[model samples]
Target: MGFSTEFNSICKFKSARELEDLFEYGKTKMRKSGFRIYPTGMKVIAFDPENRAVAIVQIKASIAEIDFQDREITLVEMDLVRPLTPEESAVETALAYEMFFRDHESN
Candidate 1:
């Protein structure tokens, strides 16, 4: 039997390099912010500090053996099931811009 999950994918990358590029771009653009991951073995959600953009990844919990507490899981072994939606992207962008300006203003 197969289980079903619901999530939205705004874009899909064919390779790890592409995903890495996107992550790098966000890091450089956002500046002083980083991504956080919440893994529950079956599902993983990654987002920025401001919680503007989020990426949800679903894994085959039945077949995969994962140690939830072990934070060393390899991304290559897991699958990227979904991406941020248009609205999520917009929110993230806006938050990032706000944070950037706020940081500079405080200096």
Candidate 2:
């Protein structure tokens, strides 16, 4: 997708209730984990069909930084990648929204 298309795709949340649903799930996890939640921002990077990655979502609110499965290069990491598929993007967005809301409910 182009830049504009990507922007529009991210803006596809049609209703507050959708976000609310995600928030509720996050709240549940937060209560169980004894952690606080914050909206840390998320991006779904689709480098490939099987390499789609979810960028940082829950950051310093619960942890300092995103460790990305221990693939941190420290000195040099890759830049922005491709766009995620519909399914992959949906999952990442839901996870981020759920995590944020869960943290809120826990606190």
Name the candidate that leads on TM-score: 1
Q: lDDT per residue, candidate 1, 3-98, as tens digits?
A: 222232212223455346445443111111112122324544444444334564443322222346633222322344566787876775566457
- Model 2 C-alpha RMSD vs. true structure (Å) is 16.4
lDDT of 2 by residue, 1-107 (tens): 11111221122222344334333443111111112223334332322212223322221122222245533111111222334467876686566456443453332
Candidate 2 residue 38 C-alpha distance from true site, Å: 15
Residue pairs clashing in model 1 are none
Alpha-carbon runs more than 4 Å astray in model 2: 1-78, 101-107
Instruction: Report the poorest 10 consecutive residues by lDDT, candidate 2.
Output: 1-10
* Per-model TM values vs. the true structure: 0.28, 0.24
Query: Which portions of model 1 show Cα errors greater than 4 Å?
Result: 1-42, 45-54, 59-76, 92-107
